[model samples]
Target chain A: MDNSVLLKVNQLKKTFIKKSGTVFNRKKTEVYAVNNVNFEIKKGEILGIIGESGCGKTTTARMVMRLMEESSGEILFEGNNLCTIKNAETNRLRKNMQMIFQDPYDTLNPGMRIVDILMEPLNAHEKNLPSNEKLKRVIEAIESIELKPAEDYLYRYPHQLSGGQRQRIAIARAVILKPSFIAADEPTSMLDVSVRAGILNLLLDLRKKMGLTMLFITHDLSTASYMCDRIAVMYQGRIVEIGPTKKIIQSPSHPYTIALVSVVKDLNYFIENREKLILDGEVDSTRKDTGCTFVTRCPHQEKVCHSKAPEIEALGNGHAVACHCHSNWLEKTS
Target chain B: MSTVLSIENLSTFFKTDKGIVRAVEDVTFSLEEGEMLGLIGESGCGKTTVAQSILRLIEYPGKVVSGKVILNGKDLLKATDDELYSLRWKEISVIPQSAMNALNPVYTVGDQIIEAILLHEKVSKSEAVKRTKTLLELVGIDGERQKSFPHEFSGGMKQRVAIAMALACNPKLVISDESTTGLDVLTQAQVIALIKNLQKKMNLSVILISHDLPMVTAICEKIAIMYAGKLVEWATTEEILNNPKHPYSKALLNATPNLSDPDREVVSIPGSVPNLVNIPKCCRFHTRCPYAFDRCLNESPELREVTPGHYTACFLEGDKNG
Candidate 1:
């Protein structure tokens, strides 16, 4: 493990068991939502985890934040195993690591004032601080997010503000603790395009200003490329590819990564000319241990792809891809 | 080219305590046969209202104030209930946003399609079921799944069924309102491809309303950019993407994150969308637009053709045409 790594996740696995059959006789089946995932986030780096819905991107983030208990794995934060920490110690660890959720409307309490929402985390973590100090901190946090005239927004309810404003309030609340790490899961997916850029830029500015390391999760590849330093492409509970943002965008190694990059519509003329590899079929979340989760739709799938699971192969330059046809892609492109 | 649908100065307002909420105001555009037009805007920009108004779906406090919706050379607003009923599904249909809730859970997927076919056309149960199976196959769904309930189908499959239901009567025009907003990227691409393939096969005109500029650019040939209840810019997809005329349109382009071009700077508009009730008499986007001038403060700009094919509603471009 790298010494500069702020968060390290090793062989993370989460499974849900469901009982089937009549009330008289019950049977159980295990649903592996996330299976043996490994990745690391260095200090001050924005590591993006991207996948389709039900692909365990959100589950991975939740496990990393310790919001959900993992079935098996090790989550190391600053040389300490977070999964083994006591309740009190875990609560303290939360002060250094925070999470920003997907939907701003649901994440925020409609009846609470913006100040109250921002102060909840502060009050919980910084209980020793006086009332005046808490108020000052809330005001400062609101100002940092560029909410403007913090006094006016302090008394306003979440419904009174626009979607973008409410999302900013959410970010302000997350950063008030000055956490060393943040996990934002689909933060801007619900926002309008005009305001989404503002939120993305805000996150980037805050990362630079506070030196915060972040795990940004999203399905939109373009956004991940814009904000993240490196990206780990997840598909069906596995990291299919991981590399620097530039390398991943320029030369995507994995077939799934290629499909994702090809789908990003843009103004570039070359993209219009290039042939699109639209992946057919749907993501099956309920399937039992299948060789190559993407085999059902891979355009270049071989007989071996369906019979054997490929291991993560290092392609050099901090890039690693998990695929059986990676050699074919290298040979064809190079 | 013959025009399939023509909207002239269409305005819709909702009577609210705040005031008359002008959701869609003085919006005019024409859709030709076999053409796909993308309506792009924020949530409250009235893109959905424009689509619903064409189908006369505006109800209660929300009413269409003025303007004519001429579909197939007939005035939809002045048409009687019987006349409108004959036109719907056969002439134009709608695929709404929520596929999960749009379908009836209690009824099997086949029964719903049969009901739709029976509503517009006098068809027997057996014949309607046969047509329903064919429609399902056209949209890339197994005909065998027609017996299954909506809850049994996956999200992507449900969306395909919705598309199938919309095309049961072979409508010439289809209006899809953010149909793929909640789906995953891969599913979104599949749904889009399905729509495009159907459009080509049937030579249908489609009105795709969504806030996602990238998705819109991928499918639609022409695009109309809306802001604050008004259409600010209208042009072919290429023209709109390559050279946006309005500040709002340019800002939207800059705001979108493009993987193909990583070096482009992201320019986010300053403020949020303004309240639609009692909108400003001047330019609606003046509050957030960076190019607002003295004229933009006092007088509203009409949608004027700035180029041979591109149109924009901005004081900055007003002088260029003159």
Candidate 2:
């Protein structure tokens, strides 16, 4: 295992047996929510997994966090295969891995006081910490998130706080364990735009202070660009493109990646080409795809693209794309 | 340049247990024939309330306390229930925020649109059905799927069906309040493109209300920025995007992460929007403004013209020197 790599996911796949039609006529069909996904996060680097809804970004994060069982493939954390780990060991390992969910309103228990919520993790891990020590740690965590004065918010329930404040408390809870890795799944998507920046900035500040590695998942391209050091663009459960943030934004290779980037509502470019929609067609995950997953929507697709899946081809400077027509596109555009 | 809709001194209030919540206060703007105006704001900044107030959709405990909503030379605020009912689908219509609940799940999409057409027009059922098919096709939905229930259609398709229903009567103006809020990026693009094309073909005036800044800037000809229930800035889309005048507008533009400039530091406005039950006596945004001084906290600023076709309500704009 490379010490620089904090976590690595290899060929991770997950499928669900969805049933349709009523009663006796029900039909069971397999939908691969996540298939053959691969990525890695370096120590203290933020790796963003971005795609449209149901594109497997969330499933990938859940699988890595051991929240959902992966059907096959390897999730290596600190050189350990987390998939085959026993329950007792997994629970112990969870102290270093935490997840922040999208909706703060639903993530935290509404009935519990903020202090108790923060204390639960500490008690579970430490087992015999004194009450005053726990209280000091909770206060320290709340103050770190800037939920000012600590005492005022310590006794309040989640409902008593606004959406922004609730999200701040959520962040505070996630970091209370001093986790080495955090999976923030659209932490700011449910927030108001004005307050969204504040949360994002807080996350960045926490990253610097704690030296944490993150797997930030989101559907919004602009937000992904802002929060991520590198981004992996997923389509139909597979990573179609992965690259540095600047390269992904400036010179996206895959047609699916291009479509995702173009759809970004940039005030400058959108004003210039408002009428041009790069791609269409919704993602149909139930389809048993043999060829490239993005063939149906790829504008530059060829005969080979419909017959066989393309391997991820590398293009220097830490950029890679899984598209057969990448070279052809390069020739045409350049 | 005929004005299709004009709102003057609109102040809407909600009688909550906490106190009288001024959801919208002294909001004013206008839309010309065949123009698209975007109302952009945060969640509780009263963008939706302004749209609801235009059609008098406020229910008990909520009232348009004072204002004039003039639509096509007539004041809609003063129009009676019967007159407003007849005027609704025929002259103005709305595509509500959530397409899933905006449409009745039990009724076929075709039947719903046809029913709306029949209620506002003197057309036979057959004629209404025919118009319904045309309207469905206009929004890119197949006429063959007209019999499908809302559940059968995808979220984007349901939104398109909602659009078809809104345009069934060829209303002169359409108000779409967060119409594409929950749709995915591709679906959002397709729906917005469909609306833009339809608006051009029919020469329909549109008011699009959303908190998504990029989506709003992409399509709207003129843009209005609302903060704490007040229209803080109004300008042509280019002017506002390029040279925003008000401090709140400037913060909003900066807060949005630009695809072109990913490395730029995004500084969020410090405090959340103030509760309207006990709004401050001065500028509503003064609590969060970085440049706010004693004057901003003591005296309220009115909307004043800062440049050609640009208006801002900030004491900083009035001060030539810091």
Candidate 3:
């Protein structure tokens, strides 16, 4: 109920049923894609969700954007529940929440010109505006993304642009409506390293210019640390750790978070002597275990980690972790 | 150390309708025994093209124009079809970029690796099957899971499987062309560590082609930086990291965000890569080079050694070295 909060997701859960076996004999099972996830984004803050593939980061973002319906929990956007909003109300809120997807190749329509793509969002949201006024706003959006002289790019198709340019057009489409909250799912992962910095700097510039709030989702810890004000590390559909970006990178508490932090390759001399705590196997989302989700791959897993589920324990200053052996590990280390 | 592969004045050109695209031009480097080299560049900078040209895998429109690719004292460029075929898996193999679809879906992972071993070596089916098991285990995959199809393994595991297949024939040189591109960061580190340990243990020379600066510097002993179909700098990891000669190399290091030093600015190099079709005989990176002079605009600089083991192809090197 904080006034400064822009988007709040409370105990969000999404599950899918998987069926197998022969045609005559069918078996069903539940797969928890996003289970009991909680996070909050302030008016102009960026919260990043970091996790490996199939760890429900995308699912959580989709449910928050109302692109995917959640099986349980509430997604409150400025104190309004997006899950239960009526069509008219949802249509109105649509202009305020936009999503930038991962792939630039698939997101934009190759056949359509850049002008039409930028105008689609405005046409849906501001139907009563004059054609000239809409065209002016579209040109402004194109320029805002730093694709200047918008006329040069307005008529060109998506295929005509480079990967970086195409992504700029995609970003232009997202910001054309001047959305306050944007959920960018791996926006720069598809981009090359040299071009990636430009996109990241552009987003940061847009945030300063428009005071935009972002839910940046990426599997790269360095990018998450750079862009996010706060970070949430998810595993097996649950957030294992969440804290301020500095705290998460410097003093991560959870075992899974520690393993993830240790594996991040930086430019500082190859972490050769760094802890080699390599987690085995990928996230198995199909497991219906009642214990901690990361128990299978955790290096410091104890008996308690298998018998009981770990709850989020606050260590201080908005820093929290869900791990059974954290206290003992801290004591042993200290 | 003995040299495993030496590429001398290698140039590969693609004949496009617009004009002849000089993808790789007069690139020269050598890989020593048990050494790992990282070829770093932007997307269209001919990093992959260099690998393809070395392996003699350049397709129809693309041809290796000139130079000698000497592998273990044998010239791959002058080799016949039969000689190249025998040299491919026995001496050189590639871990392709897309591990997800690099494999055949119908064949089991074990059978595919076994097929690779059986085709080049004169081994029986049973021996090949046994070798496949050990190869799978070498990359950290369970030997039993090799029976599963490509779809059954995860992305990282599939990449590991590809690595096992690459080493199936005991190739002397392995080209990992963006092998860890699509995997997660944690998984990428794991796969990279696997490759590193294997290279050291087996004494295998590797050519890692990637755009990831941090990773390329972290593992690879030597670094070769490419900029638009031309190598701008080649040096040891320490030399490249401590004192980069080329402006393109410095710009690349600046562009990559350092996780350890989060406060450093990540500036992107301005201007896109120039179109390669019928490119002028000047420096390809002159358009984006901050200190590009009139000479750089008119004439291309050759890769000349400034220090003992460091090579750079920038006109500014003359002013700075002296």
TM-score of each model, in listed order: 0.95, 0.96, 0.96
Candidate 1 — which residues are off by over 4 angstroms?
Answer: A265-279, A329-334, B122-125
lDDT of 3 by residue, A202-288 (tens): 999999999999999999888888788999999889999999999999998987777677666442222352343545656777887
RMSD (CA, Å), each prediction: 2.3, 2.1, 2.1
Tell me the tens digit of each residue's lDDT in model 3 across B1-322. 9999999999999999899999999999999999999999988899999999988889989999999999999999999999999999889999999899899999999999998888899999999989999999898888998899999998989999999999999999999999998787777887888888899999999999988888888889999999899998999999999999999999888988877877777898887899999999898888988888899888989998999889999888965776
TM-scores, chain A, per candidate:
0.93, 0.95, 0.96
Candidate 1 residues A86-171, lDDT tens each?
98898889999999999999999998998899989988999999999999999999999888899999999999988889999999
Pitting candidate 2 against candidate 3, the one with the higher lDDT is 3
Error of 1 at A101 (Å): 1.3
Could you give candidate 2's per-residue lDDT for residues B99-185 as a string of tens digits?
989998888998899889888899999998888888888887789788999998889989999999999888999999999989987
Clashes of 2: 0
The residue ranges of model 3 lying beyond 4 angstroms of the native Cα positions read A265-276, B319-322
Model 3 pairs in collision:
none
Q: How would you class the docking of model 2?
A: medium
Candidate 3, fnat value? 0.64
| DockQ values, each candidate | 0.56, 0.58, 0.58
